[model samples]
Target: EAAVTQSPRNKVAVTGGKVTLSCNQTNNHNNMYWYRQDTGHGLRLIHYSYGAGSTEKGDIPDGYKASRPSQENFSLILELATPSQTSVYFCASGGLDRGTGGAQDTQYFGPGTRLLVL
Candidate 1:
């Protein structure tokens, strides 16, 4: 099974400070993603990578950057953190299987990383 885990389950930062969050997956899946969950909105994708050394911006990639250095590691960087960026972040991993539709592939999620920008 695909398993994704994120570091720093919680974080606090001052406005305009820099923050970096990390993620690692054990399933060795080809696809990895970073997302944020906020009130009244479903999970929104920030970035994703198809494989090592390839990062693709998602719908809400603004204010955030991402890096995938290896098959198992992906990092999310907030260069200038703000209170509006405070939210619950999650990492997920999975690969497309013919049996499952591209959008229907079930992504395995990490526990979550909660950020608070003061």
Candidate 2:
């Protein structure tokens, strides 16, 4: 029942421009996350939100920002896009039911958006 979608499946950006990636989910989940996958760096968490109107910085928050306006929408903003930031970005939505003695978190991910910076 949980579905996540991303917009502008592919993007080409200049060295110093800005790029915004959009994501929408239908699960009404409480947590949303943004991640980037690269050759050497592997998959890294860039940003996340606990719920609507709340964005939290992840492990690799530099050069990236996140916005969650509603229960089903989240966006990632690259203020100054660079070549080093060129990679496949993915959005996921899910959360754990922490009240039950530590429930596992299972996130549903959206189709990735490939970005290339020149």
Candidate with the greatest lDDT versus the true structure: 1
Question: What is residue 89's positional error in candidate 2, in angstroms?
Answer: 0.2
Q: What would the per-residue lDDT of candidate 1 be over residues 35-98, giving only the tens digit for each residue?
A: 9999899999999999999999999999999999999999999999999999999999877645
Report the CA-based lDDT of candidate 1 relative to the real structure. Answer: 0.91
Candidates' C-alpha lDDT: 0.91, 0.90
TM-score of each: 0.91, 0.90
Candidate 1: stretches off by over 4 Å: 96-104
lDDT of 2 at 92: 93
RMSD (CA, angstroms), candidate 2: 2.8
Provide the RMSD of all predictions against the true structure, rounded to 1 decimal: 2.3, 2.8
Candidate 2: regions farther than 4 A off: 96-104
Candidate 1's error at 38, in angstroms?
A: 0.5
